[model samples]
Target: MRQVIVLGAGLAGSFLACRLLRQGCHVTLIDDRAPMSASRVAAGLYNVITGRFGSKTWKAETLLAELDAVLKDPFFQGVSQFIHPIHIYRPFKDVEEYNQWSGWSAEPAYHQLVKFEERPLFPEVIHNPLGGIRILPCGWVNIGGLIDRLQDIFRSNGGVVLQGSIPYDQINMGQKTLTWKGEPLGFDQMICCEGYRIRQNPWFEKLPVQPNKGEILEIESEGLDQLPFVITKKVYMVPGESGRWIVGSTYEHLFDDPGPTEAGRAQIEEQLRLVLKVPYKVVGHRAGIRPTTPNRRPILGSHPQWPFLYTLSGFGTKGMLAAPYCSRLMTAHILEGAEVPEELRITQFKAFRPT
Candidate 1:
């Protein structure tokens, strides 16, 4: 069996480790287990139609199908506790936007993904004067919970789990070896899925992965507890347990700190006021940096200089929906020498190639 060391235990790493194990590889998964890591703070939302224009996600059907299949697989059977299926309601800003959605809803491409409603679903609580479109196959996956479960499954399957970060200097690319704090590790290959921390990696640092910081808020609002589905306008509001609701997400390409900031909170509250009329109390706030690429596509494939080294990152805000399918592809690439799609291959970036 191929001996592999998968770095970072976030969604990407956890999924890849499990996939590698299933492919009959001996795997050791390492992580720093940072509290505010992106996967831990992610809303784990999977929406086929997203963005301000409501465009279809790239490979939405295939991604969603793989996600569903993985969730239902026997290996991840008990993860249903983290799976919450609900549609997303995007309130129309005006008559023109409503007309646009109405036309798009009947189009062949959107008919299966969205439906336009002429009448407001909740006028008292929402500011949808022009009605909205309900996006199907949309929901949140409790990513933190899913990762915990996957790690447990990995451990139960004889995969080793290591806690702590590996320093860059300890990696010997020339020798294709890794030593954690002076202790040498045995592995045939190393795959880095370090999320935003990828910027610190020497081998993959030049791949154009920008650290995009995002902040979110957890609020308690009895008025919103009855929300049957997620609501989105300037920001998204996902109903949680009891009277709690998950709101927010402010995207900041430039920031001074990685922790939650007052400015970020204000930005989220301002957007929240635009669509939600309910009163809420902020109970939790978090911040995490996502590894976003310029093209918004994930970066995957082997390192140009070191054939035994690889990276799987840049899933950005769509990591939850993309991880399952991407992990499978990475597994195949490593084990069967399958080629990664051209758009996602790190080779597309000249800097990622050998000098």
Candidate 2:
């Protein structure tokens, strides 16, 4: 029997397969492989300090460092070239805000990530009069490209990758067999890493998974590619290849279709124009639903009733960093009988038995 079977071959699923393979477990991945999934539509941003108040995110520093460590592993040496540790410049709204943030930036606790600056970046093309501070230990990942490359590597070693959905009704958990389109396959264990689509999986629908829809745009503009890093306010602009710049991300919790909309495009364009002074044309637009939780932490553990059945989801928008580290934790918990961190434990959800 195959040692493991993973559902939804996105970032979390891909990382889990890599981890299990490293531990000598025979593994297979399953997914429908949608091109415009969350992992593909995401800007892959890794910001430390976010939100309206500009405060640091939960354990941002530690997670950033852990991401660096994961990327340095032998398997990711030359292949994972998409992880870019670029600088993020947040322009101050006014002199008062600049003075206020500059004081906080001077504190020792903010040393690694906060850096105060006087001059602006690309003054000729940006409206950065109040100056800005650079957010260090931040960057982005080309998640779509990374996933594709990892899939190729995974398949090269006789790793099985089923390109269609599994039939839940035909799954015989008692016999440790899965029915993929009427074909039965045996596996010792199975894990579900389905992101926002987890609601479709009856076993995990009650776990408080919140779907957050996000939209981003790709614009083509000249003379701005040399800006060197990402810039932010309500929206952020990041450097892209070949004179293309990526501006993003508006979050909506009340949308119907998980597709691009005129309102979303307008919102991004209006905000992007305020901070940017350059001429540009909209080249691309995309939208995806993120799988988030109220607690803002990843949830990973086995089913209370069935030990062989497991789940791994709720990395939210920060999956780029969260998935790799949490996958390691999950691997250790599974292969070595180690305890999972309290925050990430699935038992935290009320009465997790199958319905």
Candidate 3:
């Protein structure tokens, strides 16, 4: 059997392990003592129209269909039919701005998403008086549950998992082997899904990884039960299953610590308080570093120096949306020797040269 060792038990790592297992490859996964990852804290909302600013992403609808297929399998534990279309309310800055956008029907992008007389998803989500626009086909994922389910599926397939970190020096490319806790393990390939930890990876350290520290808050509201959709402004309040929701995120460029900051907590709270007419209680707060590239695209490919080594990350805040399709493409490229989509190719970024 062709063996593969995967580093990092994150969303990308776990998912890749499952896919490799499905392809009948021997797989082993390693991560730190803490199993809780960034994918854990994320509210995992996927949207089509990126609202007033950004352009519509490529193949969003097709990717959504593919996601539904993979995530719907019985092996997925946290899988729920809770994937519902959300109406995003864009709080107008003023009447003048609202009128300007309303007149943008001539633009192809503006004509694609909105419709007339749409009531806001949640009544109490207060915004500017000029009302808002409705974005179609946006929804949230049970991110934590999905990660756990993937891990379970991976283990069930005879995939070995270690609780401690793997040392880079222990990896021997010439021998195609790894020494984990002083024990030798042979593998045909190794893929790193280490997220922010990729910055410390000696093999691919040269790849520009701009890790950003972000924080989020989980909250509950009695008045928010009627909210079946997501609300976004400076921050986002993504509705979760049951009566729960997540408010986030405060972006900090300098911090590496994943512990929730008082400033980040306060920023989200203040933003939430502005739109929320009803009372809500803060239940949880978490912080994690997001692995992003300068060009705002994922880094995926074999290392220039090591053909057997691969990377699969840099999905940033859109991991829930981007990973599904991107993982499939990467898996096909790795296993079937197929070509990767140009947009997602790691070579797209000039700075991603391997050592």
How does each model score on lDDT?
0.88, 0.83, 0.74
Per-candidate TM-score against the hidden true structure: 0.97, 0.95, 0.89
lDDT of 3 at 158: 86
For model 3, residues 1-355, the per-residue Cα lDDT tens digits are: 9899988877788778888888888999998835335676677878765644635666777777877877577655455543455766555555665566666534776576654323343454565456555566667777777777777777876888888877889989889889988899999999988887787888877777777778888898788777555777677788776667888887676875668878889888888877788888999888877777776677788887678889998877678777777777778888988887777677765655555
Judged by lDDT, which candidate is best? 1
> Cα miss at 3, model 1 (Å)?
0.7
Ranking the candidates on lDDT from highest down gives 1, 2, 3
Predicted model with the maximum TM-score: 1
Better TM-score candidate (2, 3): 2
Tens digit of lDDT per residue, candidate 2, span 11-95? 9998888778767788889899876567878888888888778888887767877788777777654445877888999999888
Give the C-alpha lDDT of model 1: 0.88
**C-alpha lDDT of candidate 2 relative to the true structure:** 0.83
Q: Please state the error at residue 148 of candidate 1 in Å.
A: 0.6
